[model samples]
Target: MGVNISKGFLLVLVGLFAYLSLLLVLPFSQYVLGAILIAYVLYPLQQRLEERVAPPIAAFALVGLAVAGFVVPLVVIVAAIASDARRLLEQVNTDSIQLGELERAIEEQTGQTVDLPSALADAAQNVGTMVLESSTEWFSAITHTLIGLGLAIFLLYYLLKDGSDLLTWMRELTPLPDDVQDDFYQELDEVMWAVLAGHVMIAIIQGTLAGLGLLATGVPNAAFWTAIMIILSLIPLIGSFMVWGPAVIYLFLIEEPLLAVALFVYSMIVVGLSDDYLRPILVDRYAELNPAVIILGVLGGVYAFGVMGLFYGPVVLGALIAVLDVMNDHYDRLADEPGMR
Candidate 1:
């Protein structure tokens, strides 16, 4: 009875501390996960670099490379987005948005008048006002953003340098058999590649195609919008339509009916449907994940983890699938091994 009480007390302490620990790290969870994902992807290059240099040097060099390749481009794109956003706000506030054709069509068909320009102008005002009002919060977030970035870089450096050792330590801690662990690792690696290669490649293709339509329609800053489309395409349900859809409307508002129709058709048939056909061929080759899994992941992940959930959601599902696969195979073999029940 005394031993049972002692054990219960110890369990309570463990659970209490575990919950506290989680609370401590919860705010920075995304940054931590992002560093892990980036490290996983770059580990191969780190290995190659280590062939000619020390681990620390290799890691430092790769981190610099990552900063240049990933961080620099993102910073440039963000600045461009801000510039474009300001210009767009000015245009929206000043320009007479043409909706006469649509208004006439609506009145002719439905026998009702619609004040699209007034409604749009009101919406733009609300959006601009909200942004201005929230500027203080945005400024405050910069400090947090810098901290997260610094943490990610610091963690990434060590992850690259001692990642193998860390993995070995983790492997030792797990009670699973070697073969089962191996299977789990293999599945995870494949899923990582699937997310990076299959999903990202599709985004790039859709974005590029959408950009071509924008350029053909003579939209200003087509390249900037294209880059935005590429990023938006990473989200499953929304895809690249967020950008090109607006472009279609913009063309119509500018009274380019033929170009608007052409863009709408091209984006719908080409940019939109490309993933419907290509996903099975590409993602299946690597992860064999169902489309539904990814869809659910995106929905749930976004609700739970914000923007980073886009990457996390699919990976969580993939890990679950891997666990299930390993469990099934391992137990099936064990059951088949013959026994005195």
Candidate 2:
């Protein structure tokens, strides 16, 4: 008994040491986590491609296509934006045409002086500073992009090449029974699929609708605004609102009441439907998680992990809930056994 106790104590110590070591290596851990997620997202496509060809080459080509699909457009957009950004900034700063109608309309509406010249000066100064700061940041980003991309590509390639074997090895390492392991993986898969399907679909729909609305209403920089809306739409609750609110206010200030109303109506219909209705439906269909669990997971994940937390947070929460559910099932079964009480 004493020897057994000593061995158990040593095991506990080793586990604690490993946990602390992981904490110490969290930056690398985050990258690994990100790679795992990317691999998981792309695995189905890889498998489909493998069905048609050799596994190794299929994996490489699939990852390459995925990388190109993401990187090429991103590079092109960034390059174009970088090239045009300075000219745009100069235009914004140098152009000083007064919005006489806007000022008069604002004064009429609010009984305020509406100091147009002072505001324009302030706006130009802000714009100029923003332009300078953004250019510097973009240059820094460009320097880092190659290094990051190389690392992501390497990790993705290895993950795609050996992911199945790695998963099998991990499954073997788990001390849990096979049933428990299966349950955990099942829950994890459901959560990931739900998040991927719900978030991506909703973002695309919202972005498309926003772009269409902007184009229909003759808004300048519609594509930029639409892109911004799509990115913002990843956040829960107040995503698209952030993009459309200022736009509507600007339209109102410019006395484009009809355009403002149309934009508002269209945004309400499309954005609202996608986020409020469609997303939840997909999540529910896939995850079967309690609403409270979903909300807490999202809020907690965001609080702890920033943007990526949205994907990882709910998954962790779902796994926890799944574990508890399994425990409850066993407990209830044991309680129902004859003479158990």
Candidate 3:
């Protein structure tokens, strides 16, 4: 008994050390999980291609396609924006573009002196403080972001190439009944598809459409505002309005009443309705998670994991609910047992 107690104590000690060791690399955990998700999403295409070609080649092709289809356009857009950014930065002192025209227009309409600069003095000071504070950290952030992206892609390639084997190995390590393991994974598969394909994809579509509408309607700084909308769209009930709401008001303030009305109508009809009608069909049809659960999860996930929390939050919450439902079914079956009674 003493020997057994000593062994158990050693095991606990080793487990504690292992947990502490994982904390050291906790920063990379998000990158690793992101890679896993990317691989899972693209696995179907890889499987189809693998039938005709090798798995490695199939993964390579898919990765290339992903880079070209998504990353390439983003890189092009950034490159185009960079030149404009450089010119803008160079002329920042001379231009005073932030509210120069808007302020002048407001002053003209009201026939009142608008000390917009003075009003924004606090904001400018905050910005200055932020720049001063983060000036040193920006390089570190950029480096981590770049490294995270590269690692995600690299890990994605391997996951896609050996996913089946990895799943098999994991199953072997699991102590649960084989059928129980299967059920868990099957439910996980459905939940992941619903979260990634239905909710997340639809949100992106809504954001893109909204951005196009903004651009077509001639909203200034459309790209910048569109990015904000995409991030806001992650919240189930509250979406893109946080960005475009101000834009609509700006148009009215600037005497572009017609443009303001058009933007407001577009936002109400297109951006507004898409989140309400489309997201549920995608999520509820499979995930069975109500908007309330999702909203709570989004709020909690953001609080816990930050930005990636958008995807992580919904997926984790949906998976939990799915697992619980499966457990209920298993319990229902067990209720028939005389011993259970």
Candidate 4:
């Protein structure tokens, strides 16, 4: 009893230290997890390269190539998009682009005056105040984001080279039987690729399609909204509709009925159907889960894990379900044992 008590006390102290250690890493946990996901996907390529080149050299080369090829281009695109969005916002704030035309058209149809310009002025003022209040917060956020990106890239290099050893350690540490642990890891791999690559590619495709449609239909700042739509498309069922839906309504209000009609049809048939047809193909069997799981996972993930939470949430939930199934199997085995009865 005394030994048991001592052991319990030791465990409690260890747990306390462990939790504190986790808190230290929490600020950058998203990057660590993101690195894991990217490294896993790139591991195959890394392995292929390792056969000819040295392992460390191959991993370093892969990371460098990815940063040069993928990350650099992405940053450039994002900066360009941000500049376009800023220009649009400036136009809106300065009244260079007036909603008054749309407002007058609405009032004409409904026979009720809507003073949208005044409201926009008020909105702009409120936004200005909000920006002033949040500037420091935004600075901190930007700093953290840059740090996270750097950490992710650095970690990816090592994970690509040494992840197999890590996997071995994880298996040994896991409490479950070897087979159950293997199964869980397999599921994790499959679901992760499905969630990340499947969702990201689909979102980019749909967002680009939506953006092109918007540009073709004469929507201002199509690039700005396109970036937003790509992020929103990570959500199941919502996809590009969030942008295109508002766009159609805006087009109608501006008295471009033909443009509105075209936008609506294109959104429904092209953007909407693309997700329906392609998601299952991309996600394979992982896409067959209840809709609520996806919604909750995504919402919870964003709240918990920032952007990467989008993939992390659904995958975590899937893992929990896998654990539950394993426990249920253990219970079933116990029930089958006559000695326990």
Per-candidate total of colliding backbone pairs: 0, 0, 0, 0
**Which tens-of-lDDT digit does each residue in 94-188 have in candidate 4?**
55556778888989899998888788899999999999999999999999989988998989988988977888888777655666566666766
Candidate 1 lands at a TM-score of: 0.76
lDDT of each residue in 125-157, candidate 3, tens digit only: 999999999977998888998998888888889
How well does each candidate superpose onto the true structure, as a TM-score? 0.76, 0.72, 0.78, 0.76
When sorted by lDDT, best at the front, the candidate numbers are 1, 4, 3, 2
Q: What is each predicted model's overall lDDT from 0 to 1?
A: 0.85, 0.74, 0.79, 0.81
C-alpha root-mean-square deviation, candidate 2 = 7.5
Winner by lDDT between candidate 4 and candidate 1: 1
**TM-score, structure 3 vs. true:** 0.78
Better of 3 and 4 by TM-score: 3
Name the candidate that leads on TM-score: 3
Worst 10 residues of 3 by lDDT: 332-341
lDDT of 1 at 144: 81
Q: Which residue runs of candidate 3 sit more than 4 Å off their true CA positions?
A: 1-21, 79-136, 280-285, 331-341
Q: 142, model 3: CA deviation in Å?
A: 2.8
Q: What residue pairs clash in candidate 4, if any at all? A: none
Off by over 4 Å in 1: 1-16, 85-139, 220-228, 265-270, 273-284, 332-341
Query: Model 1: per-residue lDDT, tens digit, 116-230?
Result: 8898899999999999999999988998889988999999999999998999998888876677788889988898778766777788888989988888887777879899898
Q: After superposition, how far is residue 100 of candidate 4 from its true place, in Å?
A: 23
The 10-residue segment of model 2 with minimum total lDDT is: 332-341
